[model samples]
Target chain A: MNWDAIFTSLRLASLTSLILLVLSLPLAAWLAFSRWRWRFLIESVVALPLVLPPTVLGFYILTAMGSRSPLGRWYADLIGSPLPFTFEGLVFASVIYSLPFAVQPMASSFAAVDRNLVEVSWTLGISRLATFFRLILPSAKNGVVTALVLTFAHTIGEFGVVLMVGGNIEGVTRTVSIDIYDQVQDLNYAAASRTSLVLLLFSFIVLAVVYSLNRNSPLWPTLRKR
Target chain B: MADAEKTMTNGARPLQVSIKRNFAGRFLLDVSFNVGAGPGTVLVIFGPSGSGKTTVLRCLAGLESVDEGTIRFDGEAWSDTAGKVFVIPQKRNIGYVPQDYALFPHLSVRGNVEYGIPRARREAEGPWIDRLLLILGLTDLQQALPGSISGGQRQRVALARALARRPRLLLLDEPLSALDAPTRSVLRFELRRQLKQLDVPAVLVTHDWEDALGLGDQMIVLSGGRLLQSGSPLDILTKPENLAVASVVGVETVVPGRRVRRERGIAQVQVAGLNLWAADIDQPGDEVYVCIRAENVTLEIGSATKSSARNHLPGVLLGVVAAGPLMRVKVDVGFHVDALVTRQAVEDLDLKVGSPVGISIKATAIHLIPR
Candidate 1:
């Protein structure tokens, strides 16, 4: 019952999460430590997806990446194909939709770190990069793990943006959520129920893992003891 | 000025710092001082919070960039704002111990100490860390995380971690301020011993007068982000330049007056409706403040006697307040005078709120500050 669709969704989610993590790490670090006055403007812009309607975001991305637009024409000329209605387009859309998920936790964790620790490390002759790896990352490991999980799960459950940008191409753009929608519309009740159950189990398992990890994180010492 | 010349002649490689910074058009810090960073020399910066004592220390360590002026350590320029010669904190070869004792929470005591050991020198100098831990009594606690240990132990670990670097200069910012009173006194003794043994030029900033007097080889007093005076602790306590410096160095009373006459070496001064004679009057008829320390004023039950003390005044006891080991006796002759007496002395004299007593203070004990 649409096993290829499920696998495609998993692949998309994994790739999007990996790319988002890479892109967001330095951005989050800068947001945490920079003294720039316009930092809040950038932060607000990054957080826009958290409250923006997914359809509106998808419509904008579609318009910006369509074959008629300048970016879409340039992409078509360079990549030999238009960006919209493709697997690549789906990945890009998911990354944008799940950006706040990846960034907020990381940025907050980075900001929450004691500045004295960083200064102490620097005075000890530890470079900024070394300090980030040896001290900052270990201290903020919990938030990072949460960000990765949220981004992956959010991408897996994406429907509105993926539908608008990817256009339901079989074995390529049609992920599990899109397959389930198609099944319900076609009155394939048994198939839709099976797919829905899989998603429900996946969501519960992801949340369970996150909660257990959070309990063990040293940031919540009381909860860890409990 | 004589001390500066003597320090220069001793080949002790002094750190010369003169900086002026104007911050936000509200605060200005103008300070200039030189300290001979000879072996076993401890320079203490004493001031209240927000007085820029820590700022001066940070500037010397290259932690704070100066707006104007230069900082030179052993003839090497650490910062010269006009010349655009500024060294980063890491390259300054200094061990800085902050007030919070910022130990890496993830690392054990041993790991923290070894953090600053250069990779090339780690093999040859690695044993120094163990030696430092042993000296600081942290050998058994080497495996413990900073949070797992007690506050006093964490302080030792911070000291050990800084010393492990074998730094050319050491800067400590109120290292013992976080401990309990008992622990603080205990650690202070230990820290003084360690600083002596390090044989490195060290600057410590503390608001506690006890630390300044007990640990400092030279003391620089600061107030309101400005240098009030710089001298030996004894000199600073006995010859403070102004009323502000006098109060900071534990002088309890500052009576403003003018010297009316100088007969021989003694100067008769009119102070608060009483005529008191102070010795060593270099400037006659000068407006001055007579600073008196509570400990210097002895309480006598009878009238003025022919004792060694040159000045005596009869006064009625205003109050007896218990202050730790000593009793603070407030007396009013015509003006209030405080005498710090022991509990045994209070009980022996049967002194109460209204008992009349005589306060005998020597002419030498009175410090003068030009008003």
Candidate 2:
């Protein structure tokens, strides 16, 4: 059943989601609260992944991470390896591919926080940065969870970016989606269906968890009585 | 600029503000005033909606910037557009309570109160936090989240949160506007008492006249984003400087009149073909507006009783409306005049629409502003 590919996919999705979460926190905060005149330009760029085809994004990312580029050369010098075709390259591509999934929910929720709460915090002698941590982050708990879940699931289901950036290496870069394609190409219908069923079930459960967290009522009705 | 520096040296008042800011869509805010020098002083900015009262308070708190002028608090310039100095709100050391109270829904009452204290000093500030909760009568509900508390309780939590910082100044924007009517009245006196006990200099913005009169030691009337008048609360209520100030301060009856004659510090003015006597002013103009507050008017049935009031006009009752504890009785005696009488008085006098009524207004009760 290609358990090696399954484990690799799990590792890549976990690392990619974690990296996206850390990078998206400050980026989403700036997008939500900044009054800069050119802020819409940044917002448009962040939202580009939502509309752009994965192959188009992967093409740019692959070109940028090639050994000839400055970023590629610097990373190769530091890590003694070129970026493309490695598991690290796959993680980087997934982060950019799923950027909107992590950022949109968080930015919208942060923007929805009562403006008065933030101003009151400032008036109470809390700095803006402190207020972001103390007040805003806690208020946006549901959105943060949604962002993590969506990013993790999106990274798992990704195909085009992963294949373009990280070539099909059985244990290193062949994720569940890539493994499914490899199985079908080899006319191994039984293996492909098993993997497809797992992906479908996983996606469904992730969505159910997100919707339940965001519902107005508590997920367990009995707990609300107290 | 020279004059601003001169006032800075005096330092008699604790807060001084003179700012001009232009907003989009033709709204221009230009105001200048100084609050009292003493602690426990409360200066209220009173106006109707869209009058820039909240904007003025926001400017004072450093939440909103001004296009011109300076804001001086306790001899330090908080905002000076000319000098290019603008202190952020965190460094301003000010407590601010917004209209809605804005309690953190996720935090308990105690958590909200303790939010302003630095984490390093939170342990040292524990006793103070307890005292604040006790003083505000929130000790019993210290662990209750804001969403579970009543409106009045939420307000106290917001106050506690702001006060925990031990700020030099307090800014409240329509502090009581969010509560229901009954809760608002009960909290009004309680808020006044708390402010006095705390002895903090505060600036409050409110559209409600009752809030201004009940809480302020000094009042500034604002309308159309301009400072119309500044004086004691009673003075601004009884004697507004112009028609705009008169309307903003809720003077119920204002009619244009011409001064016919002056005698013994009393001027006889003809308003709506009715001769009215008002306290005389030597403004050298005949045209004036006769402004009379509804509360200052007394309504009588049948023959007028003997009183010091100089103007008594026989009229027909036009309408009766309930206004809190009072009944607002409108009468027409050549011109419409409003009088606020107790509900019991309404029943005793059997006042009803289309009934004969008499309105007696004192000479001093009538204010005259040159048209």
Candidate 3:
């Protein structure tokens, strides 16, 4: 099996997870607290990626980032490289494809936080920024961990979107899923089985660690005898 | 103006709050009151649920802004809707203890208490923190998180955290409402003592009249988001403005009656097909409600004796309910009259359902409110 494809997949997943986490924190907070009339519009738009066919989403991203598009031309002018079939392009597509995975759980967790906590913090003379870091983030740790794990796993296992947008380039864009696809197409059953087994086992282990941590989380130590 | 001057000269910065807001076209709250800012002075806003009591506290704390009018805390405008002066809650320097305590579940007791204290000045206020922990009886549990502690401890931690910042005004919204009965009883007195020691202007909102009567030096009654009345607790209890105020204050029984005669500021009324007399009952021929407290009704087993309490009615016992130290004995004298007597009284008098008993209420105890 190709090790460069495995390393590229890991790099893409980690970068996508970290960037999505940072970008979605404020978005999830807004979704949780805002009473705007048009809030559901933004929510449905974010969740669109979850239901759309991965190739369809990739096709849209590819169209948006084509050299003919204004953003694609501007970015291509700003940078020396063209947009399609690059590691950066793959990471950007993965972020959008996995946006709902990072945002939904985060929004739910933030909504679960007692509104009284925020109000009391404000009354105690704590600023909103301080309260978010000091109170909200700590309370919503489980959801944040879930978001990270899901985003990383989802990005690692992505095939159709990366194939459509990143085009299965040998070392740069070919991830483990794309490698397994190529091995299967080349009629190398042994290599395809090995890579697929590795992906399945890795996803299981990550999910197991997350679930075990959730079971022992400080917020709900259900096994402890009071 | 004179009251404000007197309070200011005595080193007490009186809080003058007057504000109005239209809440979703359901209720319009218009309130104006003043409470002297000093130790041992608690201004309680007492009303039932959805009566705008908590809203008043929130408005003062800057958690909720008012639509019109100004809120002056020691002559500094915290909110002026027309003048465009709106101070955020963080800048108001107010301590607010909500109903759920709202302790930080992630932080240790000490960490939560010190959260509001300026970190740069935390070391200098170490003794103050120690004093608070000791006074609140939380020294041993200082390192524990809120979830690991009892309800009362969480409440103390929330209060300590609020006080750590040395707020100018304190707002307590039903601080003891979430606790069990025994804890609530114990914390009520302890909270009152601590609030007195803090010596800051406070506005406590509670739906429970017991909290208001026990902790409030002065009280305001709110119903349907309007200020019904404001006075001493005893005054509000003895003379509510209308039937709504009387009901919210938890007057045991209110009997609609027509005044039959008036003599020496005392009026005799026909109520529920029975004759009753009440003092401070001027304007004969006026419709009124005779509000009687259950605690004021005394139970007797036999015939009426020569006593100062002139309003005695013979009735049969309807039912008996043991409520803590007192037993609520419902007596039927044409209408049901609840008399809160001791459990020993029930046992001593052998009073049960259908047993003959006498309910004696003093004429002066009857609070007459115009219908």
Candidate 4:
């Protein structure tokens, strides 16, 4: 069992979780409280990655970020680079793949906020945007935390999306989950065992934060802790 | 009633809610009323459930949008459908206290009160907030969360929070409904005093007759999504517009019949269950409603020992129902009438079902409504 791989996966998961947390808050607020009737449509679109296969996202995103596709060409032509095969590309894919774990919690939490409070805030002459930032977000602290931890851990466990798009670029796209798989494919039992241990431990801690905070997290703790 | 006074005031920013909502199939709510807010004034909307009292406040607060109506505050239009003017609640600067108080469980008592206050107003809000808490007797519980607090304390917190906004108008939707009797009494008195201090226009919605009489300076009786009557509480209770309004004002009897003739102040009406005379009348009709207060009727053993009361009828006691400290004796002569009697009087008479008794109602006590 390699402590180093476990630590690396833990760090990657934490970072991914942080990134997902920042993105889901506003999007969830819009979906939850918007007067717009068409929010359901936007909600369904965001939830697409939850139901669709990871490979589908990998296929679409990979094409869009590749040199041949128009967006890919423009990205490549403008910046002399593409997102595919890069660590940043993996982060983006992880965000897309684990979006439901982050956004849904936010949407439901925001919905549960006491609408009277919102109304009171408005009657106090506070703007809608201000109400969201101060009232809606503060009340939804628990939901935001859950989304963060789940997205982070979910991204850490990714295999299909990374494999399709992020070709094992060491120190870049070679996330700990992929490294463990590579070890297994080679039938190097010692290396595979080490990588597997690291992945397990990394997942354990991210999930630990999630459980300790809110037991209603997507994943539950199998073993009880005092 | 009185407890809600300090808790909710409608001052210069009176909640002048006017709404006209039309749904596709059957649901249609058209109601309009003004709630006076200022010290020593309470506007109580009395009605049964589903009478649109709650809807009135919701429309005013911008919680429920009206298809056609106007909600104005202090002569400035809060919402006027005809003028295409509507103001969002968050932008309206009014305090709305709902039935359940709806305090955030995660927030402390102080936190709950400080919720709608902006960053700039926060510092300035402390003294006033503390005063409200002290007035509500929730000073010690400031740091406690709503979940850990008692129902009465939670109510006080809601009141404090609403007051902390220093709102121009206060709208309370049955604030004390969930509270027990004892707590309600104490809070009611405390609220009355505070309402006087706020000097803001306030409206309190309740179905309880005692609540309306005790708390309201002006009472608005609503029924079937319509405003039946709105005026001084005494006027509303003393002179209701119709049977529905009479019921809201706690008038015990609504004799749905007609006036046959009128001579001087005594008007004869052939009520469905009995023959009674109203001392006041404008027109004689084939169909009219007669309202009688339960306490206005007096009962005696025989028809001889007459007093200042003008109308007397011989009846048999049908049943007696205990209402608070008094027992309401249901008597049937030709017409069944309810006479509220003291418990001690009930024991003296040994009041039981089928006991023969003479029921006498004063001439002035009989109020007639032309149908």
On DockQ, the candidate that comes out on top is 3
Show where candidate 4 strays beyond 4 Å: A1-8, A215-226, B1-18, B33-39, B256-277, B284-287, B299-306, B320-328, B341-348
- For model 2, residues A75-102, the per-residue Cα lDDT tens digits are 9999999999999999888998999889
> Ranking under TM-score, best-scoring first?
3, 1, 2, 4
Q: What is the interface RMSD of each candidate, in Å?
A: 1.1, 0.7, 0.8, 2.2
Q: Pick the candidate with the highest TM-score.
A: 3
Q: Which tens-of-lDDT digit does each residue in A76-173 have in candidate 4?
A: 77877788987667777777888888999888878877787777667656788987877788777677776777787687778889888888866666
Candidate 2 residues B219-265, lDDT tens each? 88989998888878888888888888988888999999999999999
Q: List the residue pairs that clash in candidate 2.
A: none
Residue B320, model 1: Cα distance from true site in angstroms? 3.6
Q: What is candidate 2's TM-score for chain A?
A: 0.92
Regions more than 4 Å wrong, model 1? A188-190, A216-226, B260-268, B277-281, B302-307, B322-325, B343-350
Q: For candidate 3, what TM-score does chain B get against the true chain B? A: 0.92
Local distance difference test values of all predictions, in order: 0.85, 0.88, 0.87, 0.76
Each model's TM-score, in the order given?
0.93, 0.92, 0.93, 0.87
Q: Please tell me how candidate 2 rates in CAPRI terms.
A: medium
Better of 1 and 2 by lDDT: 2
What TM-score would you give candidate 3 relative to the actual structure? 0.93
lDDT of 4 by residue, B158-238 (tens): 877877878777778897788898788777777777777766567788987767777887777778788787777766776
DockQ values per model: 0.66, 0.79, 0.82, 0.49
